[model samples]
Target chain A: MLTALELIGIAAFAASGALAAVRSRLDVFGVIVLALTTALGGGTIRDVLLDVTPPTALVTWPYLAVAGGTGLLVFLFHPTVAKLRRSVLVLDAVGLGLFVTGGTNTALALGAPPYAACLVGMTTGIGGGALRDVLLREIPLVLRREIYAVAALAGAVIVALGDHLGFPPEPVAVTGSVVIMGLRILALWRGWNAPTAPKLDGV
Target chain B: MLTALELIGIAAFAASGALAAVRSRLDVFGVIVLALTTALGGGTIRDVLLDVTPPTALVTWPYLAVAGGTGLLVFLFHPTVAKLRRSVLVLDAVGLGLFVTGGTNTALALGAPPYAACLVGMTTGIGGGALRDVLLREIPLVLRREIYAVAALAGAVIVALGDHLGFPPEPVAVTGSVVIMGLRILALWRGWNAPTAPKLDGV
Candidate 1:
């Protein structure tokens, strides 16, 4: 059941990446590469940081197939998919939640301290999109606007708190994921932004 | 010693990243983060792909110190250092050569196939700069201009061929490094670019 949720998140991210590639007017190879990076980049980072051998993304052939297939589909039918932008944003929030939960849990399982686990979790949530934006030659949305990374960090902190309090992992993970998705969706709906540095005068 | 050469490469890359950060006008924390990422990102990717546990960059505190100290120095003395752009470029080429050699040798030591080792080597050479560019919201130079990735790839292929021919690792690494630096410097002098995709009509 958990695996199913994770796979759904991966597929949603892959689809989002495909859409971004299409919007960027990239060729087929570029689309596929971007999709794979968006779907797998975060987990790859997490696994590497936590010293997980062979990184699950590389070992799991399904990830490549799914991401690549999604890219191909979007390349062929982007106009149709582009019409569902609202739905895609919602799905992306869900992916954010799922990845945050997974990353935090993985870090904790690997004996990372609470703060490190939270950071790793947030990184896992934002890493893929950042990589995608960078590849597309645009600023990362997480760094520029909205409450994205903040939401991920909040969710990760909750998981860390639960661990510190000796709560069961499953319930903690569920709560964290729900909170992350909810906060992100609410931010999207409300047009919220994290506080940026004040503009310097005459710089 | 090989270790000393690698340290010099790390310091050079860290300095370059610091200079970039200073130019971007990032905050102190951001400068440090970018510098460390630029110094360590490539090796981390290489290690992850090769399943090298607890990546050397993470385990080695000196890497962090060197990168962080460089960031601080550049933050304070950016104007002075910026005048040495030519020197920095030369140092960067040397760093690229060293990293490619080190990465290829590490992969071979870990029993990777020659082709895989070559890819890993090239990745290690370019990954740091790519990460730095991405964080700064620029397209990776490797993907767009010059013969940078090509030089690294050529060097990696040489390393791989040497492995296949049962050549000694030390001499192979030295040869690859020299070739990479020479090619890169020549490309810079000649103002060469990798063949770009032809301009599309009316798009």
Candidate 2:
């Protein structure tokens, strides 16, 4: 079931990436590459950072196949998918929430400290999107005005808190996922931005 | 000294990044961010993948200091630095060559195979620039028309082949570095690009 959620997450992100590539006016191959990167970039980094030889993607052909198949569809049906911005964004948020939960669970399972688990969870949720924006030569949404990663961080914090409170794993994960999704939706609808450090001398 | 060489490499990459930012019409903070990312991004990824605690820049105050100082200088001295595009590119090539050797050495030292070592080398050499391009929202130079990382891979292969032949590390690294730097210079002078796979008909 967790793997199924992850596959859904991957498919959503692939579509999101295909949208970004279309916006960037990339070719078919570039679009597929971008989609794959957006879908798998964060998890790959997490696996590598953990030194978990062969990374999850290498061991899981289904993940890539789903992402690639989505990309192929987006390429063939550009006009149809172009109007899917709202739905795609929502699905991407689901992926973000799902990944945050997965990452935090993995870290805590690995015996990391609460803070470190939260941090890794946050990273797993947003790292790939950050990579996507960086590769596209755009300001990372996470680093800038977006409240995206903050949602992940919040969910991760909840995971830590719930574990500390001795809550059951299912409740902890479901509650955290819902919270992340809610916050992300609020952020998207309200255009919420993290306050930036002001310029020098208050000028 | 290795320290001096590292600082020089940082400055060279920072200057190149600043130049690119200026060309793209970015602001002061943008300039600094790009400079630092281009200078330190590759090494950061390498360190993270190796799971080095606290990471390299966090470990050495000097690396961050050098990168930040170079960013400041490049931001403040844009006009003079802009005139050195050719010189900066040459230095960039040399710096990348050195990074390839360093990455290969580090990976091999960590007991990785030649294939993994070569990958680490190529990633370290080109990863920073690729990260920079992604942040700038452009197609990465590595993904675009450039023989950049190919040069790094060739150099790494030289190191691996030489090591396999029972040569010492120092001589092997030096030979590989020189080879990468020379090939890069030749490629740049000749405006060479790696051949892309041909596109399919009506797809």
* Candidate 2 local distance difference test against the native: 0.76
Task: Go through the candidates in order and give each one's DockQ.
Answer: 0.18, 0.16
lDDT of each: 0.80, 0.76
| Model 2 per-residue lDDT tens digits across residues A117-196 | 89888888888787777777767778874577678888999998898788987779878988998988787666524354
- TM-score per candidate, chains pooled: 0.61, 0.60
Q: What share of the true interface contacts does each candidate keep?
A: 0.29, 0.25
Residue pairs clashing, model 1 = none
Best by lDDT: 1
**Which parts of model 1 have CA positions greater than 4 angstroms off?**
A1-44, A48-105, A111-122, A135-137, A141-203, B191-203
How good is the docking of model 2, as DockQ?
Answer: 0.16
What's the true lDDT of residue B89 in model 1? 76
